[model samples]
Target: MPLHKIIHINETTTAYFWYITEDVTSLFRAVSLKDTSLFRLEGMKSEEHQRGFLAVRMLLQHLGYTDYDLSYDEAGKPHLSDGKHISISHSHEFSCICISNKLMGIDLEKLKEKTLKIAPRFMEVKHLENLTTSEQIEKATVIWGVKESIFKIKNEKGISFPEHIFEDEFDLKDGKCTAKLHFNNQIENFQIHFYNVEAYIFVCAFPNK
Candidate 1:
């Protein structure tokens, strides 16, 4: 699959997903990269990482953007030439980019038993009670993504998931939740949206307006 899915988050925000089935050579040939991107691609240690990076460019092209229009700041946040907010993520075989007029963040994580095992380090273990093994894995992955999505939005140093971010009680079936970030001596609320993509979990976060 190429452009696997697109989620219209709202009037001003949209998220795009690319399922990477193409080899690096094919993906590289399909997208035009600026010199810096090419240099970064050449420096990547693994073909999987290269494919994920190119897949992001392919997604940008799908929306009338190219590598030239994408840039990164010192904090490693992505920026568009047009000034729209953009967040990018990739894991295993999936790559994603979310663009919005407002500040936002996104994350993609494959469902794994390890996430559930380490849940207590990043989230409230009580939320996993009364769930089956599979449900535990799914819910844990969502909470991890919630913290990751919010972290990407903040992109500040010293924000620990366990110590600073908290997810309110929410059911897995609800497909949405709210979270708070207690960082830099201020508490900021966020709206979270999550989905199951094959065996992966996709999450998006936007500051509460």
Candidate 2:
């Protein structure tokens, strides 16, 4: 299940998904990673983490990119050798990346009961009302991803999900929504697109133009 799907979000951005079905050794052998990436891979404490890291490289290769073309900033945001933007995320069994000419952030979250349980911590509790248990889990997962994607896009300190990011009213079936970030003395808006992929919810956020 390599390169599971490619989503053309717009003319300038695309999202790629990779289902990690290969062993760590096999994945490592398939991609040519830079020395820094190799060092980071070795330091990862879990095999699942290593596989997710390698799967990202495989995705880059699929897009005609290699580890050499990707770099991370001091804030841990990814960058391309070119001026294009990039965001990466991985959940339990899936890893994904989104590349764009515009600033963007993406997150992949596996559906879980824990996210629903902790919904009040990061989101408005009223939004969860009038929904079934399963819908509550899915909706909370999406809201979490929304904040995560926005945080990644800003990559600045002091951005708290509960205190700063707010998801406006939206229905699950809409598959898209809007959010606002009230932080750093400025308010910015975002357009969010989200959908279920396998057992995970994929969310992409782009700052309002």
Candidate 3:
């Protein structure tokens, strides 16, 4: 397989969709086969995450980065040795990355039935009270994406829904929403951009503050 072309959703965000047919070898050649192989092995945990790593690697290469070094800090947040702000997400065959001069976060999740089944775990009573059956599942999915993006941005653990992060009520028609994030004794506002693509809800969050 040839090196699949990179797809850019925007100037700062790019997504690479991988199938088993893609040229994993070429990717390894561009970077280090040893490093790519380690991520490939992680496919056992979740093929989705593995594919995401491949896409992320491709994006990094496009940005003129050949040597990619990743390490986890004491808080378990991923840090790049080069000191760039990076965020990644993968779901099923698709993976996405957001690279920016400032802090950023991105999330992509497969629209699964489980999202609906466990909606209560993440939503607050106020959110539930306003949700109608018609839009409950869709709203819940957006909120999930928001929360995941927050986790990626903060790089810290132990946050609850409704209490820590609050999303403003939004309509699916708008295709986007905003949220207020409360963390680390600071109230930071954020804007969430949502994209409905190929049965998946992709959300990207940036701090407005």
Candidate 4:
């Protein structure tokens, strides 16, 4: 598929999802990559990762960009030549990219039982109470995505998920939530939007401006 969906998150932010039904060779031939990206793609250990990487470029092309316009900083945060903020995430057979005029972060996570099993390690287990096992898995996956999105927004060192990011309680049906990042002697507030796509949870975080 070309693009699974496009979410106009705000006046200046958008999220693009790519359903990776095509094989790696098909994706490789569809997008033009710079030498460095080609090198990185060649070194990738898994076909899935290569497909994810190439799918992102396909997304860029859709947005009027090419591989030459993307770069990374010392902290491995992706940037654009035109100075917009970008965040990329892919899992399993789906890849996603978010672009915004403001500082933002996005995360895509597959719903799985493992996220629920390890919920206590990163989130407060009390929130999982009163929910069925399946609900628990879905909620835990969203919470993990919340933390991950915030982490990408900050992209600072020593920001532990459990210790630094705290997700406020919200109903699973709400499909939205708030979170706080208590790090670097400051507190930051974030607004979160999440949705379920197939077996995956897509999350987007925008810091309070």
Tell me the alpha-carbon RMSD of every candidate.
0.9, 0.8, 4.0, 1.0
lDDT of each: 0.95, 0.95, 0.66, 0.93
- Compared with the true structure, what per-residue lDDT tens digits does model 4 show for residues 94-172? 8999999998899999999989989999999988999999999999999999999999989999999999999999998
| Whole-model lDDT, model 4 | 0.93
Lowest-scoring 10 consecutive residues by lDDT in candidate 4? 1-10
> Could you arrange the candidates by lDDT from highest to lowest?
2, 1, 4, 3
Error at 52, model 1, angstroms: 0.5
Every model's TM-score: 0.97, 0.98, 0.74, 0.97
- Candidate 3 local Cα displacement, residue 193, angstroms: 1.1
lDDT of 3 by residue, 1-209 (tens): 32333444457555443332344444445554345446545554754454455656665566665434655567756566678766767666665566556677878777776887798777753565566664666667888999888777876666776579888877777877888878879887888788776677778888887
Please identify which of the two predictions, 3 or 4, would achieve the higher lDDT against the true structure: 4
CA shift of 194, model 4, Å: 0.9
**What lDDT score goes with residue 127 in model 1?**
94
**Positional deviation of 126 in candidate 2, in angstroms?**
0.7
Q: How would you encode candidate 2's per-residue C-alpha lDDT over 14-116 as one tens digit per residue?
A: 9999999999999988999889999999999999999999999999999999999999999999999988999999988899999999999999999999999
Q: Could you tally the backbone clashes for each prediction?
A: 0, 0, 0, 0
Compose the digit string of candidate 1's lDDT tens values, residues 83-190.
999999999999999999999999999999999989989999999999999999999999999999999999999999999999999999999999999998899999
> Where does model 3 exceed 4 Å of error?
1-48, 67-72, 79-83, 125-134
Q: Once superposed on the true structure, which residue ranges of model 1 sit more than 4 Å away at CA?
A: none
Residue 145 CA displacement from its true place in model 3, Å: 0.5
